[model samples]
Structures are given as C-alpha cells and as structure tokens.
Target: MKKIYNNLTFRVLTAILLGILLGHFAPSTAAQMKPLGDVFINMIKMVIAPIIFLTIVLGISNMGDLKKVGRVGGKALLYFEIITTIALVIGLVVANLIRPGDGVVTTGLATSGSAEAVSRYAQQSAEMDWMDFFMHVVPSNAVGAFAEGDILQVLVFSVLFGMGLTRMGSSGQSLIRAFDRLSKVFFNILNIVMKLAPIGAFGGMAYTIGTYGLAALLPLGKLMITVYVTMFLFIFVVLNLVLRYYKISLWQLLKYIKEELLIVLGTSSSESVLPLIMDKLEHLGCSRSVVGLVIPAGYSFNLDGTTIYLSMAVVFLAQVFQVDLTLAQELTILGILMVTSKGAAGVTGSGFIVLASTLTAVKVIPLEGLALLLGVDRFMSEARAITNTIGNTVATVWLARNENELDMKRLRQVFNKEEIDPLANYDY
Candidate 1:
C-alpha cells in the first residue's frame, strides 16, 4: 500500500480523478487551479532547451563518424514522411466513411468565445509562409533561439555545433566531457521537476473541465468519437504492424512507458514529458545518438497525431457546411496538410492554426465552420498528444534497431523487471 501511494503513476491517476470531480462540482474554483498546471509545464520547459542542446551536441561529438550521422538522419526523415503521410491518408479515409459532421445544424451557432479563438489562429495562419518556415529554422542568433525556446532552431544550431566539434579531433575531448556533465545536471533537474507532475496533471484536468464543461462534448460528440476511433486504429493497426515486424510487442512498450502516457493524458501536452521519454528510451537500450537526434526532430517532423487531426478536422468542417469536395480537392487537402502540419511544431494553438491555414488554402470550406470545433478541441488534444508520444517512441526504437545500436539483451532484462538499472551510470 505504501509503495502504491508512492508510485508516480498511481499519484497522477488519482490526481486526474480528483481533478475531474472538482471540475464537475465547483467549476469556478477548479478554473482558478490553472496556475498549478502552468507552473509545472514551465518547470519542464526550463530544462528542455539545455537538455536538447547538450544531448544533441554530445551525441554527435561522440558518434565519431559523420557519414553514419547523415545516414541515420536521412533514414529517420524518410520514415517520418512515409509514416505521417499514411496517417494523413488514414484520417482522410476514416472521415469520409463516417462523415461525422454531416446533418449538423450550423445556423446562429454560439460563436461568442469561439470566434475570438478562431480569429487568433486565423491571423497566425495568414502570416505563415512556406519560405519563411524554412528560413526560421536557421536561427540568425543562437542565443535568441535558446531564449525563445524554439526546438527546430536549437536543433539546427546544435547539429552545426556538434559537427564543428567532431572536426576538432583530440582537441575537443575536454569540451565533450564538459557537455556530458552538463547533460547529467539537466537530467537531474528534470528528475526534480517531475515530482510535481501530479500537481500539474490535476491542474490541467481541472482547468480543462472547468473552462469547458463536459456538456461541450455533447454537440460535437460524433466528431470527437470519430477522431478517437481513428487514432486508436492508427496505433493498434498501423503502428502495431510496424513494431511486430521488428519483434517488439506494442503492449510491452506501452506498459514500460505507461507513466509518461498518463502524464501526457492529464497535461495534454507531449512536450511536458519529453525529457522523461528520452531518458526512458535511452534506458531501454536505444543509442544516445539516435535518441538525441530522432526525438527532437520527431517532435517537429513526425507529428502523426496532429496530421491525422488536421486532415479529419478539415473534412468534418466541410461536411457540416454541406460543402461537397471532389476527389482532386481532397487530394489537394492531403498535399496541403503534409506541409501545414509540419508548421504546427513550436507554435501555440498550432493545431487550429494549421487547420485554419489549410481551410483558407482549400477555399472550399467556410472558415466560419471552425467556430464549431473550438469548444471541443481541448478534449481532443489529449488524444492527439498521446498518439504523437507513442508514434515518436516507436520511431526512435525502430531506427535504433536499424542502425544496430539497440541492445536486445538489456531490453529483454528491463522488460522482465530485473534489477538491472539502465540509469545507474547517470545517477538520476
């Protein structure tokens, strides 16, 4: 009983339940609990920049072979594109078949708060350009990138810095050691911040339910149900088949990272658990180089869940507005989503912004239709964040296996709950 009470998983699960109850009873009080969640996420964000910088730099410096780095990055990007495209297709197909938005009345719908939310995303979307996105990746000032906490910009700078260190040969040995030590320090900090996850989870759940009461789900219930079902199929059918080919059990992996999943579930932000997942993957025997490279890159490039949601949301809105899209128009949506979804990373309210941009580009769906979804988007965000976390985890492990960097023996032992501590060296 003591152990159960002390367990992080149990604590977070309990917090979620308590949060829901509080929200259901005293929504005004529960809404004020937002600060707890905000503070927790801020704590996590504090270490993310340093961790990404140190991890990527250290991983690349130690790799010793530049060609292998290029090969790994190439393969990872290829995998991301293929897998995310498949996810988009699956979302499109599922939305069309179910037509979750059909037969919905859209006259004089309550767009009070929703209109303002949609307007903000629409403005952001309008300002975005493909050329500008590519240009933004190359930070003009490295310190600015870190200060702003832009993951892609930091990733770009880190890769260059790592490559420069690799060119120094024996001269860079001291620098690499310093970076390794720094990484440990940041991970230790992460360990400390994680203790507040239950508080964060509770606050997040309470605020979500309080701000948008459970009754908000009733009208858009069909779209919500369809989105959840499609994501479920993608995980079990698409992701499961990929894992089985590599002789890994999806169930086992889920069990191993169940704690992180629960965190993401409550927080509805995959970024909240980024450091923990990276640490867990390394402990599971994935190469530090691969985990370093793939995870951050995956956060931006491999957004399987967001892509699925974007594609489905567009289709749903069109159905609600009684707009009939031709096959070519639908294909255009797929192509547009492939690019728009990638832009979602590092931007707040990006999922909606990306959807707004896609709808504007398509010029078929009424942009006003977006008002219908703003109410329920928060509820669906948890599903998207969880699926994205799972997809990236699988991608990292699979890439590690392909590169011959995974230790199967250690993996087996850890899964079996043996006493072997993969983090023993790091001392986290």
Candidate 2:
C-alpha cells in the first residue's frame, strides 16, 4: 500500500483527477496553476539539449564506426517516413468514413471571430520557409542552438562532434570518459526533476480544463470521438502488428513505458519524456548507440500522432465548410499534408501553423476553421503526445532489433521485471 502510494503513475493519476475537480469547481484558481506545468516542462527542457549532445556524442564515440552510425540513421529515417505516412493514411480513411464535421453548425462553433484567433498561426505558416527549416538544422551558433533547445540543430552538431571524437581514436578516450560522467550527472538531474511530475500533471490538467471547460468540447464532440478512436486503433492495431512481426510484445513494451505515457498524458508533450525514454530504451536492451540515434531522430521525423491529427483535421474542416472534395482533391490534400506536416519539427505551437499551411495549400478548407480546433485541441493533444511517445519508443526497439543491436536476453529479463533497470524501479 505504501509502495503504491509512492508510485509516480498513481500520484500523477491522482493529480489529474484532483485537477479536473478543481477546474470544474473553481476555474479561476485552476487557471493560476499554469505555471506549475510550465515550470515543470521548462525544468525538463532545461536538460534536453545537454542530454542529447552528451548521449549522442558518447554513444557515437563508443560505437567506434562512423559508417554504422550513418547506416542506423538511414534506417531510422526510412522507418519514420514509412510509419508516419501509414498513420496519415489511417487518419484520412477514418475521417472520411466517420465524417465528423459533416453536420457541424459552423456559426455556433465560435467561428464568427475565428479569423482573429487563428491569424497568428496563419502568419507563422506564411513565414515558414521549408528550405530555411532544413538549413537551420546546421546551427550557425551552437550555443544558440543549445540555449533555444533546438533539437534538430543540436542533433546535427552532436552527430558531427561525436564523429570527430570517434576519429581521434585512443587520443579521445579521456574526453569520452568525461562526457560519459557528465551524461550521468544530467540523468540524475532528470531523476530529480521527474519527482515533481505529479505536480506538473496537476497544473497542466487544471489549466486546460479551467481555460477551455468541458462545455467547450460539446460542440466538437463528434470530431473528438473520431480522432481518439482513430488514434486508439492506430496504436493497438497498426503498431501492434508491427511489434508482432518483430516478435516483440506490445503489452510488455507499453507496460514498460506506462509511467512515461501517463506523464505525457498529463503534460501533453512527448518531449517531456524524450531523454528519459532514451535512457529507458538503453536499459530495455537497445544499445546506447541505437537508442541515441533513433529516439531524437524519431522525435522530429516519426510523428505518427501529428500526422494523423493533421490529416483528420483537414478532412474535418472540408466537411465543416461543405466543400466536396473530389478524389483528386483529397489525394492532393494528402500530398500537401505530407510536406507541411514535417514543417512542425516537434515544436509545441508549430502543429497549428503546419495545419494552417496545409489548409492554405489545399485552397479548399477554410483557414479560419483552424480556430474551431483551439478549444478542443488541448483535449486531443493527450492522444497525439501519447501516440507520438509510444511510436518513437517502438521505433527505437524495432530498429534496434532489426539492426541486431538489442540484447534479447536482457530484454526478456527487463520485460519480465527481474533485474537491472537504469531508470528507477517503479514496480508499476
């Protein structure tokens, strides 16, 4: 009983319930709790850049073969694109079938002043230059990349730095040891920061419900149900089949990462568990090199959840505006989303901008329809974040097994809950 009470999952679940109650009864006060979530996310972000740099550098240097690094990276990217595109198709198929926006009354959906609400996203979308986005991957100022917590930019630098260190061979062993120690220090910091996760969960849930209220979802309930069910099926059906093909058990893998899932559930940010999950994957039997390369790369490229949401939102908006898209137009929208979706790069608010860009490109869906999503978007982010987190985790494990990098015996031990967990033993 005492152990259960101390459990992170239990505490976070309890916090979520308390937050819902407070938001319902005293919204004014609940809104003030935003800082709790914000600060906690900031705390997690505080360590992300350094963790990525150190983990990648150490993993690369230790692996001792730069060609293998490139191979693993290529495989990871290939996997990301394939899985995410499938997710996009799943979203479109489900949305077209259910047609959540078919009967939505646009006027009552707070659409009157929607232009003002979504204008900033439109502006951001217009300002986004995809060439610039790809170019920005090579950080002009490495310090600025770290300071801004730019994962992609930091990633580019870390890979090169690690390669450089690896080429030094025996000459760089001292530095590698120092980096390995520093990485452990940061992981310890991660452990300390995570203890406050329940508080963060409480603040996040309270702020969302207080600001939007359960009533806000009523108007968009059909869309919400459709989105959730689609994601659920994608996870259980699609991801499960992938796991089964690889001879890995989806249930054990999800059970392994349940704490991180709940953290993402409460916080609505897959990034909140980014570094933690990387470390957890290594302990789960992935080589450090594979975990390092796959997880962060998956973070940006393998956004199964975001792709699903983007496709479904486009279809939903077209239905709302009574725009009858022919088969060609729908295919064109799918093509447009394929490009625009990558523009988000896992940024928090950028998902909306990418959606705006997709809508703008499609030239059929009302750009103002983006505003209809604001009230219900937070509620759906849990689904997106959870799926994104799980997808990345699965991708890493799958890639590791395929590359013959996973320690199958050790994986069995960890899944069996027998011994050796680098991330604390949560017995959940």
Candidate 3:
C-alpha cells in the first residue's frame, strides 16, 4: 500500500480522476486552477534548455567524430520525414473513408468566442514566413536563444559548440567532463521538478473540463470518436509495424514510459515531459549523441500527431461546410499541409493555425468552419501529444540501433526490469 501511494503513476491517475470530479461539480472554482498547471510547466521548462545544451555538447565532444554526428542527424531527419509523410497520408485516407463531418448541420452556428480564436490563429499563420523561420533557427545572440527558450536556436548553438570543442583535442576533455557533470546536475533538478507532476496533472485536467465542460463533446461526438479511432489505428498499426521491423515492441516501449505518457495525457503538452523522455531514452541504452540530437530535432520536424490532426481537421472542416474537394484539390491540400505542417513547429496554437493556413491556401473550405472545432480541439490534443511522444521515442531507439549506438545487453535488462538501478550505467 505504501509503495502504491508512492508510485508516480498512481498519484497521476488519482489526480486525473479527482480533477474530473471537481470540474464536474465545481467548475467555477476549478477554472481558477490554471495557475497550478502553468507553474508546474514553468518549473519543467526552467531546466530544459540547459539540459539540451549540456547533453548535446557532452555527447558530441565525447564522440570526437563529427562525421558520425552528421550521419546520425541525417538518418534521423530522413526517418522523421518518411514516417510523418506516411502519417499525413493515413489521416487523409481515414478522414475520406469515414466522412466524420457528413450530415453535420452548420446553419446558424454561433461563433461567439470561437471567431476570435480563429482570427488569432489565422493572423499568426499569415505572418509565418518560411524564409524568416529558417533564419530564426540561427540565433542572433546565443544568450537570447536560451533566454527565449527556443529549442531550434539552442540546438544550432549546441551543435556548433560541440564541433568546435571536438577540434580542440585533449584540451576539450576537461570541458567535456565538466559539461557531463553539469548535465547530471540538470537531471537532478528534473527529478525535483517532476515531484510536482501530480498537481500539474490535476490542474490541467480540472481547467480543461471546467472551461470546456463535458457537454461540449456531445455535439461533436462523431468527429471526436473518429479522430481518436484514427490515432489509435496509426499507433498500433503504423507505428507498431515500424518498431517491429527493428525487433522492438511498441507495447513494451509504451509500458516503459507509462509515467511520461500519463503526464502528457494530463497536461496536453508534450513539452512538459520532454526532459524526462530524453533521460529515459538514454537509460534505455541509446547513446547520448543520438538521444540528444534526435529528440530535440524530432520535437520540431517529426510531429506525427500534429500532421495527422492537421490533415484530418482540414478534410473534416471541408465536409462540415458542404464543400466538395476534387481529387486534385485534395492532393493539393495534402501537399500544402506537408509544408505548412513543418512551419508550425515552434508556434503556439500551431494545430489550429496550421489548419487555418491550409484552408486559406486551398481556397475551397470556409475558414469559419474552424470555429466549429475550437470547442473540441483541447480534447483531441491529448491524442496528438501522446502520438508525437511515442513516435519520437521509437525514432530515437531505432536510429540508435541502426548506428550501432545502442547497448543490447542494457536494453534487454532495462525493458525486462532486471536492472537493479537503470541510471547506474550512466555513472549516476
């Protein structure tokens, strides 16, 4: 009983249930709980930049082979592109076949708060310039990058710092060891921040239910059900097959990271669990270089869940507005989404903004249809975050195996729960 009470998983699950009850009975008070979740996420974000920077620099400097770093990064990006494309195609096909929006009455629907939300996303999407985005990846000042908490910018700086350190030969060894110790310090900080996850989980769930209410799901129940079903199929079928080919089981991986998934489920933000996932990947026997390089990049480039949601949301909206998209037009939407989806990486409310941008580009679907989804978008985000988390986890492990960077013996022991202390190998 004491062990169960102490388990992180048990605490999170209990928080979720209590949150739902509170939201249902005392919504006005529950809505005020947003700060609880915000503070928790802020605590986690405080350590993320330093952790990523130190881990990447240490991993690269220790490897002492820039060629291998380049190869790992190249393969990781290629794999991300291929898998995310397949996810887009699957979402499109599933949406067409199910026609979740068919027969929905769109007449006289009140936009109310939703119209403002749509306008906000539309403006953000319109302002997003591809050239500007690429330029933004190269930070004007390294300190500003970390201060702003820009992952891509920090990633760029870390890689260059690591490469420069590699060229220094013996002189870099002392710095590498220092950075390695610094990484451990941040991980220790992570351990401390993670203790508040239950409160974050509770607050996140309460706020979501309180603000939206369970009744909001009733009107859009069909679309919500379809989205959940499609995501489920993508994970168990598409992602499972990818892992199987590499002799890894999706179920086992899911079981291993159950705690992180629950936190994502409660928080609806994958960023909340980013550091924990990176640490787990390393513990699972993936080399630090691969985990450092692949996970951070995957957050931006390999958004499997976001792509799937974007593609499906577009088709669902078209159907809701009684618009018929010809095969060529649908293909055009797919092409536009493939590019626009990548642009959403760092932006807030990216899913809706990406959908708005896609509809604006296609010129067939009514942008106002977006207002219809505003109510249920929060519900679907859990699925998107979870799938994105799982997809990246698989990508890191698979790439590590391909590069011969994984420790098979350690991997077996960790998954089998035979390792007495998982962090022992990392010299903790």
Worst 10 residues of 3 by lDDT: 419-428
* Candidate 1: tens digits of C-alpha lDDT, residues 300-353: 999888889999999999999888999999999999999988866778888988
Tens digits of lDDT, candidate 3, 5-27: 99999999999898889988999
User: lDDT by residue for model 2 over 75-147, one digit each (tens)?
Assistant: 9999988999899899989999999998888776664466776998998888887897787778999999999
lDDT of model 2 at position 252: 96
Candidate 2 is scored at a TM of 0.97
Superior candidate under TM-score, 2 versus 3: 3
TM-score result, candidate 1:
0.97
Q: Estimate every model's Cα lDDT from 0 to 1.
A: 0.90, 0.89, 0.88
The parts of candidate 2 lying over 4 Å away from their true place are 111-114, 421-428
**How high is each candidate's TM-score?**
0.97, 0.97, 0.97
Q: By lDDT, who's the top model here?
A: 1
**Candidate 1 backbone collisions, by pair:** none
